[model samples]
Target: MNTRKVYLIWFFLFIFIPLIGSAKIDDSHIRSVVQILIYDNYSKEYISSGSGVSIGGTRVLTNYHVVEDIIKQPSRFLAIICLTQNSQSTPDCSYTAHAYYKYGIAGTSAEYQEELDLAVIYVNNKKDTNGTWKSIADLPMSEFSFDSINPALYGYSMTNIQLGDEIQTLGFPDYGNNTITYSNGVVSNFWMDDGDFFKDHDGVLAIGTSAKISHGSSGGAAFDKDGYLLGITSAEILDGNGSFLSGVIIPITTFNWWWEKVLGYEIIDGVGYTTGSISKEMFCKILYKDYDKLHNTCVCPKGYTENSNQECIAGSTPGSDVKIDNSTSLKIDPQLTNRLKGYILLQVQSQGEAWYVNSVDGKRYYMKDGSTAYEMMRKFALGITNSDLAKIPQQGEDKAYLSALSNLKGKILLQVESHGEAWYVHPKTGIRYYMKDGEAAYALMRYHSLGITNADLDKIPEGIL
Candidate 1:
């Protein structure tokens, strides 16, 4: 071959090859994809199944099964279309479907049966000024010729998945909850079975991944590496070990006949449409239900009242009289001794019991019965001495006094003697006096200091002294 001919062939091949590779959908396109949430009349609750692809201007492409019954039984079922994005961060957007069209059920018993599971619905905007119902745009449909199966299969597989891909399957399982449950797994296989479609009596099986599929995931969309709409995740086979064998996905080509006949549009080359900003209130209502009947529980968090199907309103303030009993002792950290002291002082002022010592982390410390503050200090290895007790000044009259001050200091070391009233004579200071009683004999307690004003002492009952 001539050099000029070879160079021309190479240039053509490079351009065409890259275009072929670019034909497949990627993950970025899938983020705009959504699942269909529907209310089931039989269960009397919300359920979800997959279908998605935001074509443009809020229009979406989805399967018939996802929105079928809701369209047929409007009063019994409502549709909530969710756009799949970062489910953890971005809240799932929900739109009430306003209109829908079904295909492939014509002239067959399967039409009325469960098999013709394909349909497209227009999602309703919560706030439409013109009152005209809006539909999410369809995904760009690629052309496929049945004669050339290899290229068609390759295109579908590449669009459907990447090796080691982790994808979610959105579906309504038998439990019948409205929330979308995601099952993630890697792509295990990709193959085509011309006879398998006829055998299973469905559409073409162009791609297969190992992601889990349940009773409700029949119409969900499978996104590719760049998050683009690739194929519809359909079914799964389970083994005896409770493990999923393979997930079957129908390629976009399966919808080609319906797209042309029902939708009446040609496949275009471009990104899918976008929708208007979803309302926060509408979004919350569709994504989460306000009532859960099975458990007889309200979906709203505690302290909020259910305002609607999916909303909550702030309720009245909690009753102040509903007191939580503090019968258990709270332990204090030794390192927070000053804080504990302040807490004890406050409790004393409030006439509340400063019943126990607690650790910083909230574990309680207990003291033995008949243990005084001095005895407790000794037990905890504080080494408080006899001389320290003698320093406390005496007060009041001699008949009320119980002993000489020096001997009283030694008596205070005994846990049983330290609590309650005691009369002590200060022999060296020439003063006879009295000491006040506490709650219990030998209980560790803080004494009212001599500096305590007479007014404060008068507040105490005469009998309590």
Candidate 2:
């Protein structure tokens, strides 16, 4: 007899047999839950581990903090999602994934993550010889029949459930030998976690449940009787002596906000608009670096500023003249004016070639390759004086940089004496994110990417000229 089989027999004889009267949790759903393993290069072992739920396709939804270390030191830290178990008490690392995006950035405070602790990491989906990139939906499973079991299904309720509703949570919590742990309890109550130790601020809404979960259960899913995701298991309340009191679940609606605002996708009626027809309003909302109040238009791309004629142009030094005549205007339609400006447009008709739409001139620049894109970005870099650069601050520093960052909101800055390296000074958080090379710029462009059809893309002229 296998040790795992023996353990399963005893577990069922004690745990599941007694909970027969409670809500039914399908076996497939239990198998669908996966474990997150964080391997540290220096330690040469998995230093930390957490749990996540497969939210269809190749993506696994988990708490942002579960993989925050990977975001900080991506090269040194590797994140692997394990889905199956052979015989050991630990998870089987058969699937490798990349940290796609988290709700917040690396230095964002714990309180902010607590309010919206969500992240989406995905696998390659190419099952080569090693089978490390297989999607959760394509993996083989047992012959267990299910009522509504589709591994790629993502059904969640939009409305909040009432108190006393029975809830069940599934995750690979600690002390359970890495096996999936299922715990059931009624909805205890709900409150808002303002991230204020003194409770002085108002914050996002949270759900409270009496379900039992451990430290490793941070990214698991809380499901209702009908097998819908109620919320994500985020944090637990502990007493003075470290005893478990209650569990805090971040609501599902927060994921909607993150999908649109952070991941650059617009959600409508619970579905996302992912085709080449993304709207101009959504494109500007997510990609704008600043607002040109003089012309009432958006200024985009780090290197360019909007001129008097509402065209994004290079070089707007305090004394330089960028006045353009109205006769030189591109004569673009009123509806499409500045619509695709500042967007990383993909020429879908030509082998997926890339182009960047300058916000000022409304012209497209060919990014023939990564190196060219990087150099082109440096060509229009804004040179700031040492005194002016000193006014801006780094993360964990003073709040004085807030006003400075606001004034230069979304501008790419080059230190007066530095090696011509550029830094993106974030407008909101007052922190500088280093744009190391063209690869980094390409990635950021993809994050800010919006698909454009050939017909619509041709409307904009080509090149910085």
Top candidate, metric TM-score? 2
Q: Give the least accurate 10-residue stretch of model 1, judged by summed lDDT.
A: 1-10
Model 2: lDDT of residue 61: 73
lDDT of 2: 0.54
- Model 1 TM-score? 0.37
For each candidate in turn, the TM-score is: 0.37, 0.48
lDDT of 1 by residue, 346-410 (tens): 13344432222221111112222334432333322111122333444545433233343333321
lDDT of each: 0.37, 0.54
Q: Which stretches of candidate 2 lie over 4 Å from their true place?
A: 1-21, 85-91, 100-115, 125-159, 193-204, 261-263, 267-465
Report RMSD for candidate 1. Answer: 30.3
Instruction: Write candidate 2's Cα lDDT for 316-404 as tens digits.
Output: 33223322454432323323425555556776666777777654345677877768767655643454545556677766777476452
